[model samples]
Target: MTYLNGVQVSSAAVSTDPLSWLDERASERTDAGLRRHLRVREPESPAIDLASNDYLGLVRHPEVIEGAIAAVRRWGAGATGSRLVTGTTADHALLETELAEFVGAQSGLVFASGYAANLGAVTALAGRGALVVSDAGSHASLVDACRLSRARVEIAAHRDVAAVERLLAERTEERALVLTDSVFSADGDLAPLTELHRACRAHGAVLVVDEAHGLGVRGDGGRGLVHEQGLAGEPDIVITATLSKAFAAQGGVVLADARIRAHLIDAARTFIFDTGLAPAAVGAARAALGLLRRDPTMATRVLDRAADIARIAGVAEPDSAVVSVVLGEAQLAFDAAQTCRARGLDVGCFRPPSVPTGTSRLRLTARANLTTAELDVIAEVLSEVLADARGTERISA
Candidate 1:
C-alpha cells in the first residue's frame, strides 16, 4: 500500500477496495434510515403523482406527446453535438425566442438540464475575484454553482433580506451576485424578489433568481414570479428555469439580456462543452408553453389544488403549487412516504441533507389535473399519516 494524502492506496484491487469507504457510508446511511432506493415507475402506473414537478399535469398531454414524436422524427433521437457545432437546430432557436419573449427577456440560452444552467450561469458570471451572496434555502444546484464559481460565497439566513443586503453592501469585490430561489423547494415559500432586487440595485450587485418552481405556478398566465414582480425586463436581474418542472420537458434555460446571453454563449463552460438540449425536449416544452399561453387558467387550477392539499394536510397554503408536510426524523418521513405509496399516492420524501437535520418532510406537489377524487384520497391517507407521525414528529410543519 502507498500513502496518498494520509490515505492508504494500492494498485492491485484498487478499482474495488479504493471505493470501500463508500460501503461504510452506505452502512451508516442504512443504520440511520437514510438509505434510498429508486422505485421503478411504469408508464401506466396507477399511483397518484404528488411527488413530480409536473405542476400543470401536461406531461401526458396529447400535444406534448406529439411534439416529442414529431421532433424525434424530424431531428432524430438527439442533438448530435454541442450547440456551438451542429446541435443548434431551427427548433432550438425558435424555442429560445418564444421562451425569452414569454418572460420578457431579451434572449435565452438552453442547457442539457436545469442543474447545468445554474452551473453555467453562476460559473460564467461570478468567478474568483467576485462575491456570491446565496440564500440558505437555495436548491442544491445553486449551492453547487456557487462553489463552482470559485467566488467568495456567503449564505444569508433563509429569506433574510437584511442579511443579504448587508453581505452585498459589505463585499469588497468589484463584482457581486445575489442568488435566490423564487420559490424555495423544501418549504414551498416565495422569496422577496422585489426587495432583493432593490438591495442589489442599491449596492450595484447582480441578482440571479432560480424560477424552477415559480414559472408555471405563479404570475398571471404563468409568466413566473419575476414577471409578476415586474422585474422580468430588468437587465441586472437574471432568471434560470427548468423546462422539466412546469413544461414537462427535460432541459433548462437562462433568460437574460442579449448581452448577457452573448457572454454566456462565449463563456459558460457548461453550454460550450455539454451536449445541447435534446430536440424532443425542445419540442415538448414548446408545446407545453403553447398550452400554458392558450389556457392560462391552468396555472390558477394548480394553485387551487395546492390550497386544497394544504387545507387537507393542515398546513398553510403555499405561494406556489408545493405543499410540504414536515414529519421530522428520517425514518418517520420514510414511513409516511411508504404509507402514502401503499395508499396509491406517490409523494416526495425529503430527509437530511436534502433538508436540515430533524426536518425530514413529505413534499406534495399539486397538479392542475388532479381530480377531486384524488384530493379526497390524499386527505384520507395524509391525515392518518400526519396524525400517526405526530407521536414522533419533532419539527413543526
Candidate 2:
C-alpha cells in the first residue's frame, strides 16, 4: 500500500489501471441518481425561461448589448492579461469605482467570475493560523475557499447565529472571519445579517457576506442586503457579489475597506494570477448598473414576479428571485422539470449533492419581463406537474 495525498492505495490496484476506477464511480453515481448532463439551449428558446438566473431580464437589452459591442470595438475581445500585468483598462477602473459607490463600500475589485471573487476574498481574509467560521449552507465556492484557506474551519449550523458566535468566542486564533451568503442559493432564504454582525463585533472577527443572490433584489434601489442592513461601510464587513445573475453580465466584485482592497490586490492569488475580467463583460456590467440606477423599479418587478410564482406553486414567498419547490426525490424532481419543459416551460432540477439528501427540488427563477400570459402558462404547467408527482408518490408508497 502507498499513500498519495493522504489517501492509501494498493500498489497492485494502481498498477492494474488508473482510469478504470472512474467508470465504477460513474456507475455508482448513476445508480444513486446523482449523474448530471448538460442540455444545449437554442439561441431563441420557445419555452418560458424559469431556469436562467437573468433576474432582471437585461441580458439582451439594447443598452447591455450595445455596451458589449462598444467595448469590443474599443478594447478588443479579451482583457489580454492579468490585472497586475496588462489587463486593467479604463472601463475596468470605472466599473470598480461605480460598484464601490453603489454598494457604499470604501473600494471594490473585479474578478473574472463570482467563484474567483469568493475564493479570493475568503482565502485572502483568513489564511494560515486564522479561524474561519462558515455557515453550513454557503455556496460551493465559499466552501472550497474555506478548505483552501489552511485555517481552522468550523461550520456552524445553517443560519444559527448563536452557533457562529460560539465558534468565534471559542477560537484560539486571534484573527477570525465569519462567512455566509446573504441569500442562500438553493432555498432563497436570507441570513441574519444584523445578528451575525453583532456577533462578529463582540468577538472581534471580520464578517464576509456573499451577496450573489441579494444584490439587485434586496436593498433599496438594488444596493444589496449589506446596504439594506446599514452595514455597507463597516470596517469589519466585506461583500462579494456576482454580476451574472441580476446584472445579466459576466463578472464578480469584492467590495471592502480600502486597506483590504489594497491587500487583496497584492495577495489574492486568484486576482493577481488570473486574467482580468473581459472588456465586454466589464462594459455590459457597467451598463446594467447604470440601467438599475436609472430605473430602480426593475428590482421591485423581479420580487413581485417571484412572489407571484411562489403563490402559483403553493410555496412560501421567496426573499429573492429564486423560488424552490421541494419534490422529495431526484427522479421525481427530474420528471417534474421535464414535464414542465414539455409544456413550454423551462425549470431547473436540483438533486443531491446540490441539495441535501431527501430534499430534491425544482428550482425556478423569476424574470422581471415575464408577462401575464407567460405567468399563466407557467402556473398551469407547474400545477399539473406537481399534481402528477404527488399521485406518483402516493402510488409508490
Candidate 3:
C-alpha cells in the first residue's frame, strides 16, 4: 500500500485508479464549503444582473452586434495563426491605434486576453537580474506574471505606497517593475497610483498598472485611473486592460511608450506564440469603445448606480463598479448569494481563494443601463438577505 496525496491506496488499486488522489482534494473542498459550480446561463437571464463586469451594458447593443458581424464577414471566424505569421488583421491594427489614442498612450499592443497581456508585458519587460514589486491585492494574472518573469518578486502590503517605495529603494537589481491593479477586482478599491508612481520615479522603477477593472469605469470619459491621475503618457508607466469587461468583448491590451511596445512585439512570448485576438472581439470592443467615447457620461452613470447599490446594501460605495458585502464564512456567503438569486437577482459570490479566509462576500457590479425598477428590486432583495446574514463580523478595510 502507498499513500497518494494522503489517501491510502493499494498498489493494485493505484493501477486501476491513477487519478484517485483528486477525489481527496475534491472531498476536502466540499467539506470546507469551498467547492465551486458552473451554472449554465442562457443568452438572457431573467434575474436582475449585478454579477457581471459589463459596466457600460453594451454587450447586447445593436451597434456592438453589428460590429461583430461585420468583422466576421470581413476577416473570417478565427485569427488562424500567431500575429507574427498571419493573424494580424487590419482591424487589429485599427483597434490598437484607437485604443492607444483613447487612453493617451504613445502605442498599444493587443493580446489574446487580459491574462496573456499581463504575462506578455511582465515576462517581456522584467526577467533575470530584475526585481518585481507587486501589490498585495493585485489580480491573479499579475501574480502569475511575476512568478514567471524570472525576477525576484516581493509582495508589498495592499496599496501601500511606502512599502512599494521601500522595496524599490532596497532592491539590488538594475531594473525593477512595480505591478498593481488600478482598481482591485474583488473589493473594488482604488490603488494609490500617484503616490506609487512618484515613488517609482524616485527609485527609478517602472510602474505597471493593470486597469482590468478601471477602464470604462473610471476617469473622465472612461480613460482609466492612470489617465485620470495624469500618468497616461508617462514614459515609465505601462497600462494593461481587458476588453472582456467594460468593452463588452474579448482580448486584452498593453498601453505604453512606442519603445516598450516594440520590445513586447519582439520578446513577449505570449504575443509571439499566441494567436492574435479574433476579429469579432476587436470590432465589438472598438464599437463599445466608440459608444463610450460618444457618451462619456456612461462612466458616471455606472459609478452612480454602484453608489445606489452600495447605499441600498448598507455598505460604503466602492471606487469601481464592484460593491461588496462581506458576509463572514464561505457557506454563509454562498447561501446569501443563493437567496439573492432566488429573489430574482443575480449577484457574484466570492469566497476563499478570491478573498481572505474570513472575508467571503456577495459582490454586486453596477451597470450603466440598470433601470430604476432594477435598483429598487436589488434594494429589496439585499435588504432581506442582509437582515438574515448580518450576524457575522463586518468586513475590514
Candidate 4:
C-alpha cells in the first residue's frame, strides 16, 4: 500500500491508472452534497451583495480609486520584483510606516497576502525546536503555518484560555508561541484576548493574533481589538492583518516589535521570495486608511448592520461584521443561498471543510453602506428559505 494525497491505495490499484482514484473521490463528493463550482459575477451586479469582505465599503470610494490610478501612473502596474530586490518602492515604505502608526505597533512588514503574512510570521517565530499552542478554531492559514513551522504543536480547545495555559505550562521547550484569530471567520465569534494574553505572559510565551476580521470592524475607529485591549505594541504580542478585507486592497501586514520586524525581514521566506505587493494595492490601502481616520463612524455603522442581520436571521448577535446562520445540511445551505440569489441577494454558503461536519451555514457580511431596503430584502429572502428548510426537515422526520 502507498499513500497518495493522504489516501491509502494498493500499489496494484495505483499501477493500473494513476488518475483513476480521482473519479471515486469525485463521486463521493457528489453524493455528500460537497461538490463545488465557481460562477463569474457580473461587473455591474444587480444583486445586493452580502458575500464580500469589504466591511467598510471602501473598495470603490473615490479616494481609493484615485489612489490606485495615481500609483499606476507613478510606479507602473507592479512592484517590479521582490521587496529584497527592486520591489520595495517609496509607497511601500510610506504605507508600512502609516500602518504601524495606525495599529500602534513599533514596526510593520507587508506581504503578498494575509496567508503569506501568517505563514511568514508563524514559521519565522516558531521553528523545529519551539512549541506552538494554537486555537482549534483558528483560520486555515494559521493551521498551515503551524504545520510549516515543523514545531511541536498543541491545539487548545477553541477559546479556552485555561487549555492554552496548560499547554504552555507543560511544554518542555523554552520557546513557545500561542496563535489565534482575533475574530473567528466562520461563526464570527471573538477570542478572549485579555485572558489569552495574560496566560501567554504567565508562561513567558509570545502571542500571535491574526486580526484579519477584527481590523476594520472592531476597536475604537477600527484600530483593532488588540489596540482596544491595550495589547498593541506589547513586546510579547504580534498582529497579522489582511489589507484585502476592511482595507479593500490586496495584501497583508505583520505589525510587531521592532526587533521582530527585523527578524522577519531576515528570516521570513514568504516576504523575501514573493513579489512585493502591487503598487496599486499599497496606494489603495493607504487611501482607505486615511478615509477611516477621517470618518471613524464607518466602523460603528458596520457593527450596527451586522446586528441588524443577526436579528433578522434569528442568530446570535455577531461580535464582528460576519453573521452566520446555521442550516445543518450542505444541500440545504446551498439551496438557501440559491434561493437568496434568485431574490436578488448575494450571500455565501459554507459547507463541509470550510465549517465543522454538521454546521453548514449561510455566511453574510455586513457592509457599511448597505441600506435599510437591502436589509429588508435580505430578511425577507432568509425568512422564506429558512421556513422551507424547516418544512423539509419536518417532512423528512
Candidate 5:
C-alpha cells in the first residue's frame, strides 16, 4: 500500500473531440467524389434496381419468402449461440447436407457469411509453412484472408496460369493453396478455372475457388463453375459460396471432401467462435436452391438479362450478369449515378479504391425477374445519364 492514492485523478471528464484523422479521410474521399451513401428502398419501389446482387431474382419469390417466414416461426428470431454450442439448428444441417449433395461434394460446412467462410477456409488450410497463390483481381475478402493466414502470398496476374505455374515451380515449400474467384465481382469476368485447376494439379497444390457470383449464373442448372469444369468431386478442390447473393439469404458455405469438412468443423476458429447463420436464411436458401434445381430457367434468364444490358447500354460485352459502363472520372461516375437516381433507376457506382484509379465505371447487376420493358427503361435512363455527365465534365474542364 505504498502511496496508492498518490495518482488520484480529477473527477471532471475529458472533453470529447471529433477525430481529425477520420475527418481528413472523409474529406479526401469527398474531394475524390468517392463518398458512398445508402438509400432506403421499399420492396415494390418504382426505381429500377441494377445495383443489387440478386442476379437470379429469388429474393422476392413467394416460395423463398414463405420459407423464411416459416423458419423464423419454427426456430425463433435469432440463433442464440455459436454453431459449436447451441446455435446450430436442423435447418442449418439440412441446408449443408443438401448443398453438399447438389454440388457433388462429399460434405459441407456453413458459416455466418461468405467473408467469414473464406477466412476460415484460408487460415485453416494454409498454415505457417504453406504458400498461398492468389490472383491479383480476386475479391477483397479473399485477399484479406490470405494476408491473415500468415502464409507467404504470391499474387499472380489475373487468370494467368503461366505465372502461377512459374511461381509454384520456384517455391521450395511443399504445400501451397491456390485461390481465385470463379467470377470476378467488379468486372463479372470468369476466371480460367479449368486451366487453373490443371496448374494446381501439376504443382501438387490445393485449389480454393470462390463461387460467389457463379453459383446461380453458370454451370448446368446453376450447380457452379467447378461443376462445369468437372472438378466438383475432386479431392484437391474446394469451393466457397455466399447464400446472400444468388439465394438472396445470408450465409456462407464450404464444399469439399468429407475429411476437410471434418477438419473445418473441428479446427476452423471462425466457425467455432461466430454465431451460426440464422434459421430464416438457411430455410430461404434451401428453398431458393430447390427452386433453382427445379426451374433452371432462372439461371438462363439472368444470363440473358446481363447480355441484354450490355448490348443495349453499348458497354463492353458482359461475360455474366454484371455490365460495367465506363465513366472517365470519379466525379463523372458519381454524377452518372445521381442522374440515374433522379430518373428513377438505381445502379452501382464504382470509383477509386474499389475500381482502379482512372477506370471509374457504373457497375450494373441485372436480375432475371426484370422485364424487357424495364430493361429498355434502364438503357434509356443510363444513356441520358452518361450524356449529361459527359456534358457536365466538358463544361467543368
Candidate 6:
C-alpha cells in the first residue's frame, strides 16, 4: 500500500506554473478595459463624492459621530465574542429593538454584514427539498445564499410576478420562498412588492425582501421599501437591510415575524458563530434612525438630487438615490470614470459582473449635504465628459 501511494503521489506532483486559462482571463479583462482598481483618498479630500452610498449624508453628522464615540467609550472597540458567547452587548439589544420598531417588524437580529445577514436568512429559512423562487437580478449575496442552501432554486425573470406564480404552481412541494430586492442596486429600479406578495399568498409561499438600498431612502421617514409597500407587518414576510448605506453605520439586520426571529436567534450560523456588531456601529445606527425620524426632509432632498443628476445626464432616469449613466462599452465607462475623477468628482464604474445584462455604466449616488453649487459643477463636468466621450468614442484622459 505504501509503495502504491508513493507512486501516485509522484505522478500527482506537477511543477508550479500559472494556469493558461487564468492568464487568458486576465488579458481579456485588460483588453476590454474592465480591470478594477482601488483609489485611496482621505476622508477630508475635496472630491465631488458621488461614489459612496451615504444617501442621507449622515456619515459626517455630529450626532452619528458622537453616538459612535459614546458607545466605544462605554463598551470598547470590539464585540469581544460571538452573540452566543459574550458579544451580545447592551447597545446591540437597543439597536435591534429600535430597528424592528422602525421597520414595523416584530423583532430583529443584527449581523456583522449585510451579506452575512442575507446568507443567514436565506440559508436558515430554507433547506433541501424546499423551493426558492428568486429574481434573476437579485444581489449576489442572496444568490450565493440560495446556492449554499442546497435547495431547489428556480430563477424567475426579474420582477416577473407571473413567472414566479407559474413556478410555484408547477412545483409539487408545499414549502417555498420568493426572494427579491426592494430596490435593485445597479439600475435603482423598484420591485413590484404588491404583486409579489399577492402571488406568494396565492401559492402559500413566504416572501423575503432585501432592503439594502431602500432603507433610509424609502417609505415613511425612510422605514424602508417593505414599509412603503405596506407589507412591513405581514406574518410571513422577512426583510433584511444594511446599516452602512443610509444609516451611515456599520452593520446589517434581519427583520421578520417573531417566530422566525426566534428561530434565527437559535439556528442561524452567521449569527451564532460570528461576533456581534460592534457597540459603536449599533449606537451610530440608533442615532441615525433617530435623526431620520426627526428630519424627514433629508430623504426628500437626496432623492431630488438624484433626480436632478439623471435629468442632467439624460441617459438613465433614476428611480431612487442611485443613477446609472449608460456607456456603450466597458473601456469607455472606465475612462469616463477616470475623467470624472480627474475633475475631482468621484463616481462608481460598473462593468460586466457588477451590472445586470452586461451593461457598463457610471453609477452616481446623491447625498443630502451636497450644496446646489457643487451639484451644478458636477452636472457641468459630467455633461462635458459625456459629450467628449460620445464624440471621440473614448475619454482622452
Write down the TM-score of every candidate: 0.94, 0.95, 0.95, 0.95, 0.92, 0.93
Q: How do the residues 150-243 of candidate 5 rate in per-residue lDDT, one tens digit apiece?
A: 9999999988999999999899888999999999988899999888889899989999999999998888888888998888899999999999
Q: How close is candidate 5 to the true structure, as a TM-score?
A: 0.92
lDDT of each: 0.93, 0.92, 0.94, 0.92, 0.88, 0.88
Q: For model 2, which pairs clash?
A: none
- Candidate 4's displacement at residue 237, Å, is 0.5
How high a TM-score does candidate 3 get? 0.95
Better of 3 and 6 by TM-score: 3
Better of 2 and 6 by lDDT: 2
**Residue-level lDDT tens digits of model 3 in 236-296:** 9999999999999999999999999999999999999999999899999999999999999
lDDT for 302 (candidate 1): 94
- The TM-score of predicted model 1 comes to 0.94
lDDT of 2: 0.92
How much is 141 displaced in model 6, in angstroms?
0.6
Which lDDT tens digits does candidate 4 get at residues 137-207? 99999999999998999999999999999999899998999999999999899999999999999999999
- Candidate 1 residues 1-397, lDDT tens each? 8766678878563554777889999999998989989778898989899999999999999999999999999998999989998749999999989999999899999999999999999999999989999999999999999989999999999999999988888889999999999999999999999999999999999999999999998998899999999998899999999999899999999999899999999999999999999989999999999999999999999999999999988899888999999978999999989988998999999999999999999999999999988888888888777888877343232
Better of 3 and 5 by lDDT: 3
